[model samples]
Target: MAESFLFSIAESLIAKLASHAFQEASRLVGLYDNLRDLTKTLSLVKAVLLDAQQKQEHNHQLREWLTQLKTVFSDAEDLLDEFECQTLRKKVVKAHGSTKDKQDPGVLSIEDVGVCF
Candidate 1:
């Protein structure tokens, strides 16, 4: 159960990392390098998770560690969600302009944000 959950989270994060909106957001936020590193790290984690899942059947410590890792993955997922939301909001504002032309300080106004990758 834990393995499947973790696998799903990793897959979701990887998909988000590859998304056009997220890629643009990362570039605007100057996280292109960080995003590349994260992609590599998550690939490693997914590889290790397969072995860990098999071994965890007899190792209580490994199970506990997986639980802790789940929390970390949850936090990472939330962070990616925030970036995706901010990027999408910026796109909407740029397409239609903000309501009443009131600028949102939180949403960045980026023109022609090219993806680093």
Candidate 2:
């Protein structure tokens, strides 16, 4: 009977050890899966950061282009204004010359009534 009891006790100990080993193995697998997920998350974060950096560079370039375009537009406007002034001056000179030819000698000059600078 003693020998039988010893065998039973040994069997119980073996079963407990097996159950503990299984629990440990399950915990290790869970830890490994968590580590894999963390790695993936880190990779995704890195990709996002890289994309943001590229976008920032693009925005900087766009701002520079916009500034250059504004300068060009300002220069064009100034040139247009200068051209318009020249055309207006020519028209006024032509009109003045034509009016002078049509005026009578007895007429008083309109400029005589104005204050002299």
Candidate 3:
């Protein structure tokens, strides 16, 4: 009878140990799952940061191009203004030569026009 009692006690102890081991294993599994979730979150954050950096770089490049385009536009405007001024100057010189010729009754030669362009 004592042997049976001892065997029963041993079996109960083993059962308790098994239950504790199973609880510990479940806790470990939960911890592993949490770690896996954290890793995925970190990866997503890294991707977002990289994308933001690339966007910033692209914006910087666009700004630089805009500045260059503005400079080019300004230069084109200056050139057009210079061309208009030269054309007006030529027209004024031709009108002056025609008036002088009408007053003097002389044909105005190209050399007398003094127009360079």
Best by lDDT: 1
Candidate 3 lowest-lDDT run of ten: 1-10
Across 3-57, the per-residue lDDT of candidate 1 in tens digits comes to 8799889989998898887777779889899998999999899988888889998
lDDT of each: 0.83, 0.45, 0.45
Give the clash total for candidate 1: 0
Clashes of 2: 0
Return model 2's CA RMSD, one decimal: 40.9
Q: Candidate 1 — which pairs collide?
A: none
Worst 10 residues of 2 by lDDT: 1-10
Q: Specify the highest-TM-score model's number.
A: 1
Tens digits of per-residue lDDT for model 3, 1-117: 222333333343334323444335436546445434544553453444344444545476644644453454445445434544555555677777544555554766444775433
For candidate 3, the clash count comes to 0
Error of 2 at 34 (Å): 68
TM-score of 2: 0.34
